[model samples]
Target: MTATPPHQHDVVIMGGGLAGLTLALQLKRRFADIDVVVLERRAHPVPHAAHKVGESSVEIGAHYFDTVLGLRPHMHGAQLRKFGFRFFFSEGRRDIDQVTEVGASRYLSVPSYQIDRGIFENYLGEEAARNGVRFVDSAMVRSLELAEDAHQPHRIEWSQEGKTHTVHARWLVDACGRAGMLKRKLGLAQANAHDCNAVWFRIGDRITIDDWSDDPAWRARCEPRARWLSTNHLVGAGYWVWLIPLASGSHSVGIVADPRLHPLDTMDTFDKAMQWFQTWQPRLYDELDGKRHLLQDFAFFRNFSYGCKQVFSGKRWALTGEAGLFLDPFYSPGSDFIAVGNTYITDLIAHDRAGHALEARAQLYDQIYHSFYESTLALYTDQYPLFGDPEVLPVKVIWDYTYYWGVLSQIFFQQRLTDMAVLGSLREELQDCQRLNFAVQDFLRAWSGVSRRRNRPVMLDQAALPWFAELNRSLNDRLDDEAFKARMRASAERLRALAMEILERARHDNPTLAAGELGTLLAEKPARLRSDAPSEAMLFEPG
Candidate 1:
């Protein structure tokens, strides 16, 4: 008698968390007739707010979720709209209002959100199933047999309810996050130079920053008095504390620090974290002193930032999300990278469906994706020392956002991530911007070394900068080909000018400031420099 044949599908996604489920939804939307199955380890209806740590979204991730996936209604309805990133240099102080504050006075044109991962994932599961994706929760992937030939289908075996099942698929994806099912199996794991540790927890009650201060002027700095809505960062020498509001009425708090200055052993537990906070951040300690019982969860990770050797392959299998690579969470880039990886994988699968050559496309996409990773990695590596330097940090934040919005965000927003010709044309400009960023990060570190670490009382409002605000608003513009190219050229000039300005300011503060390539990079003038160069007012001035 012949045995029963395994079920067949076009795609089989392992570990149906954020990356896998979202990828499933994207594939179904991109190709309605494609057969896709997502195997998830955890059961459905997971608890909200306390489920995960990455609950923040920036521009690229927000656009991917809202516009790309058409989930704006759900996001707007369920998640809290972020006011923008707010930073306070209030280390070891109880009076946060007197600290040098850096943030927008109002919301930026481009929107982001404080996500409740559990809430969003549950919705995604339902949505994917509704759209014909076979989302099997509480299903554990037992084994995988990747096909060597492009013509053959990969086989996957999973167990659900103590019953084993097998399926064959043309494409396989490992979105298992840090579990890295395929990455481990293929020896694709790699470590990064950044050796920072992180500890995060969620409190059942809302911990509002707005209520921390009673001063009228401080409360009125942000329009509508919604500072609580922002992703607030409390920065110090080797660490930063984050306070993010969740839609489920819980507050997420975290401490991310370089182990050299702040060892993980110090704040690895609830009681220890409170003691550490008392010495480093007295105001936060005071708030949580009596509310220890409101704590819903606690977790920590050593050296959270990592790199994957290879995420995409011509062998019909790919890894997305934490299963692949992860950069720093300072800018909340976890979801942004997720969006990027998912897009690349979807494009590769599309190539396979069209009977096109997968080897070349896979190689090119891998290069471009890793290039992006390295570019972003420069922002965090060896930069924690400057977290407490109020003067330099405000300047660094402006430059960082400029680079993000001007270059990388443009490629993504214009749907040009996979456009080889456009990318080829802008390669020089992108490289210049990247080189400048490296120099700038080094430049900032050097600047901080000589910094006075000024803790002023003024609020450095980003929205007040007209050109800066305009650059952010440009994300919404749907530009034609010529317009997009022109925009990129303008962005290149904008970044060059900003870099020159930052270098000049650093030198102005300390004549012996050391920065490599900044002077030479700013010297080369292919395009005319903008007449409206960034001024000293862009930075926080010494009183």
Candidate 2:
């Protein structure tokens, strides 16, 4: 930035948290000789397992750690293998399983983890250093000087131990979480419609969901019955409470809500959060009442989901993780995006170092990346109002997961992320899913408006649902290109049929309900769905 700095590395990454550390390790692993430096603001040995909020991983992020990054050994030894997601729609009930619950009876075929952020980050830092990547701790980045010319290197200035330092690099990456250092410096911040708020705390010991109920039938629903290992959700109007177990025997509890309905000020403190829980989720509140003295930490954030104007650029700079864009944490996608964005950044640097033109690829990546972000955003934005609708919310969950596993997840698992021709061919299908998502979200809102909350006591076992279970197992299929496309096409048709089923159920429940956008989507005759595909029976089946 100032002509040139005295000392330089091939790449300089800011914010040595999860994203930065992972990227550093990835770069060194891919291009062994490439010089990389990671600057972290906090000193190491931050804490044990309860360091950060996001500890759970879904499929894509889990795959990034296990298959792509080759961290399977550590994953099995140090982290907890996640039981599939569980949701309890017991708004005011003390008996949890007696209420309408949706979850799997057995583990899914694929793998994910309940990560202890501190433990994972510590391991990543050590691995990065061991693999010849320079990891600097307690280092604060002051400024980023992105070169106007694509061919020029970027310059970064940082402060460490009361001393200022400057370094130049061919590539600069920002992985700072919410700080968004470079994002704010360049005025790249943009707002989304999902103005959600969150409050989370770590308990000193595990708050086992299983211990809350003593009904033998409820406990026997699972095969290897251990409900506490799952990322359990206690849902109500406009909010959901997450209870995740850490490897250190502590539990991570969070309450994320639509700010308008459940104000952040209402639950900003431990006591306040307890009161809110007691009002909405009495079962969870009763469970935590005895453990109040063992509370570890509490924090809150308003409007956590956001967008960035530009993440990747031909200007030799890129943004990753929370420094770029953040979708709602409803599904824990932060690490998945880190895996994806980090891969793209390293790929760009690799191309540049090999003397290849990367401008076109960067542009394409940006378009596709933002497209993915926007598509996922549709799942959470303005959808929180339906969180407590026991009938519609369950249906919404099925459809949301179908779209996720079928479209985006297939691309990731098939290792076809950068495959433009494939993405182009599936353009119509992806667009349909996005449009369908918007329509369904609207329909749920309308459905919730006219419908009543049937907080009935019953376990809606997800594993017993044939098509749902099939989709979960299908993730492991080793498909050729032909079969993959066929599968995707089948998935799209299934979604179409699923939409029809959802619309029909809503109409049956609310005779006076206006179909709105959902009616319009169903008006257009979809292509004939497969005979064996899911039907209305599959969607409306009893547990």
Candidate 3:
């Protein structure tokens, strides 16, 4: 018998999860006739609410899904519109209504969703197939032979129905989530300083936080009474509990903790988690008490935050999603980064198709991607200790969201992620923002150490902050190069003003509080300085 030849495609994407499927759909959408194949290990229609962990979406991720991919109809129909992030400093307390609540009292201008992963990915697979993508579900990739040079095609061996098959492609992408077949084969795994663990599960019924309290005052705290729609966080000294609603009438719950404070062994299983919750979050325990039979799934990850040495390559191979790098899920940035990585990969593929040399482009994208990862890592690294301090965490959250919306979200919303000239022009402002963030994070930690961990009964409504709300609303504004550059400069100015306010407030409360690098970063720049600095009222006043 003669040996059979393998089928060939323009791009071969491994793993049929959210990342792989979305990449295929994006390539098809961009190139129209481009041949792409996605190999997925799991069968179609995985499950409903209990399938995956990443359920919440922020501004960037939400924009990517709702606008970039043109899935607004499906999202609006099948997913829950998020009511912004809600927080409660109700650790070890059953009275969640009395805790310091920090969140928007109403919806923001932009929207995000609480996704049902299984439903969404299944829909993505169907969409990919409709768009002429060769999606092979239940097909496990057995091995890969990545071409060393651009002229040759990379080869993939996969097994389905107990039969082996082979395929060839000009480009190869690994979106295999944590399996990271390509990452492992190429020795791309690395570690970071964030040492945290997580345990997550989905309950069969909705765990409505609004219904947990009946006080008219607490119920009326939010407009339209929709706190259940928000990605709610219950915070404590070293951990935060997430409550996200799913379209499937289930509620997703998770505990993310610094291993140093709350060890994994304390809540690795369902019984243990319930017991742990009873101790730390009695309100949640009460809600889940009789629903043990409704427990759908439970899973955990140790040291979840990781780094990849490389992702994009000149040799027509790349990695996206978890195969590349993951910072932290604190702000629901997983899908946001996926959208970003996939965009970069698609652009690289376009460059290759145009017969352009990819070495320089690939290296530049990798550098930019790594810069994003490192910058986001700063937000979570050594910051868990401050999660419980209601007084400080609200300030940190406000500042963090400002940085996200003011700088990075602008790049993505304005569709300038790949514009080298624009990025170069705004590099100094971006760097200034990053440095100011580093200093402020340090300052926050120090403030949390000395100040009173005030947990008041009032809501720190984000919408009340005029500039903050406008910064978010401005994400959809159209701007040319100069206007965009001006926006970046203004954003940097906003960050500087906010950093100064935080320093001044902290100093006023605790006169010994260190300003760290704010003295240099917040200093006036002759070329561009704002005369109208933000008022002290921008932040929540001390009661």
What C-alpha lDDT do the candidate models reach, one value each?
0.89, 0.85, 0.90
lDDT of 3 by residue, 1-543 (tens): 011678888999998998998889889889998999999999988999989899999988888888888889999999999999999999999998889999998888999999999899999999999999999899988999999787899999988988889899999999999999989999999999999999999999998899888889999889866999999999999999999999999999999999999999999999999999999999999999999999999999999999999999999999999988888888999999999999999999999999999999999999989988888898999999999998899999999998999999999999999999999988888887888888888889889999798789889999988888888999989999998998888888888778877888888889987666766666654224465435546688775
- Model 1 residue 218 CA deviation (Å) reads 1.1
> What residue pairs clash in candidate 2, if any at all?
98-457
Best by lDDT: 3
Residues 1-543, model 2: lDDT tens digits: 222345678989998888998899889878989999999999996897568889989998998898888899999999999997889987777878678888888887888899999888999999899999888899888887888786677878888888888888888898888898888889999999888999999998888888788888888888645788889988888899999999988899999998889899999999999999888889889989999988989998888889998888877789999999999778889888988898788888888888888888899899889988988898888889889888888888888888888877888888778777877788888788788878987888888887777766777777778788788778878887777778888888888888887777877767888888877876875636687577536574522
lDDT of 1 at 8: 86
Model 2 spans > 4 angstroms off: 1-5, 525-527
Q: C-alpha displacement of 132 in model 3, angstroms?
A: 0.7
Per-candidate TM equals: 0.97, 0.96, 0.98
369-411 per-residue lDDT for model 1 (tens digits): 9988998999999999899998899999999999999989999
Residue 107 in model 3: lDDT: 87
- Candidate 2, residue 142: lDDT: 85
TM-score of 1: 0.97
